[model samples]
Target: MADGCRRRIVLPREPHAELAAVPLVDLLGERLGFSRDTLAEIKLALVEACLNALEYGQGEVEVEVVAHADAPARLEITVTDHGAGFDVSIVPQPDLTAKLHASRKRGWGIELMRHLMDEVEVHSTPGLTRVRLVRKRKEA
Candidate 1:
């Protein structure tokens, strides 16, 4: 992959816009030869990020995917939004031991992203919030 192997999509903050990540992941899978499992992981993480943006963001959401040219090639995806972002540190961790029905359905997105991707980074401020997901390319 070359440095120019990057695509960016701007989406309206709507529920349907979350589906856009599906085709984007498909393109990445075709171009990078991602494994089925890897593609699924990427898709889930992307959807979660997009949903979060649509739910909390005030304006358009941006999704960027880049395939790096370095050895042991990697894919870097970023989901960003310009909105009144909150403090990530304050989000409570899910208590896995608790019954699913009783547990609060919050804070799982970030945790799921971290669990599925090789690297996950979240940055948030008053005007901008970014979630970065990275995964190594599977060897063919």
Candidate 2:
């Protein structure tokens, strides 16, 4: 597929908690022709990023999705916020083999986001934080 197939989106800085998120998620899924299950996972991942932005981001938030409908079946999405960003290193990794009862509250978002996506990338400075996520399409 041509690079023209790539898709991207940007949300205004500090979007409303309950508004604007679902539509963005839907648009991303529709653009990629993702399966129902994949769509759900992507939607949740997008929402998680937005929620984190609302909680910690200050100015504006930007999100981008790029789709390549070929061999790898891939989707690339990036979320950016102009707020104080965290050091990605500190988030704890979940021990799946352990019981799920001892869950902690604060850092689960990063953990889940990383697990759900095939690739996770973070770029942050004092006032800007950007996260890139990728999910490969199913093989034909």
lDDT of each: 0.81, 0.71
Q: Name every residue pair that clashes in candidate 2.
A: 7-65, 13-60, 73-137
The segments of candidate 2 whose C-alpha lies over 4 angstroms from its true place after superposition are 1-8, 12-25, 94-104
lDDT of 1 at 78: 91
Q: Residue 91: error of model 2 in Å?
A: 1.8
Candidate 1 differs from the real structure by a C-alpha RMSD in angstroms, to one decimal, of: 2.1
1-140: candidate 1 lDDT, tens digit per residue: 45457888998655589878667776765577677878888889888889888888878899998876476677788999988998888877777666366746566888888888889888999989999999888666
Worst 10 residues of 1 by lDDT: 97-106
lDDT of 2 by residue, 27-139 (tens): 65566667778877876777787778767888777676667666576777778888888888876675655535556535567777887888888888889998888887665
TM-score of 2: 0.76
Q: What is the total number of backbone clashes in candidate 1?
A: 0
Q: Name the top TM-score candidate.
A: 1
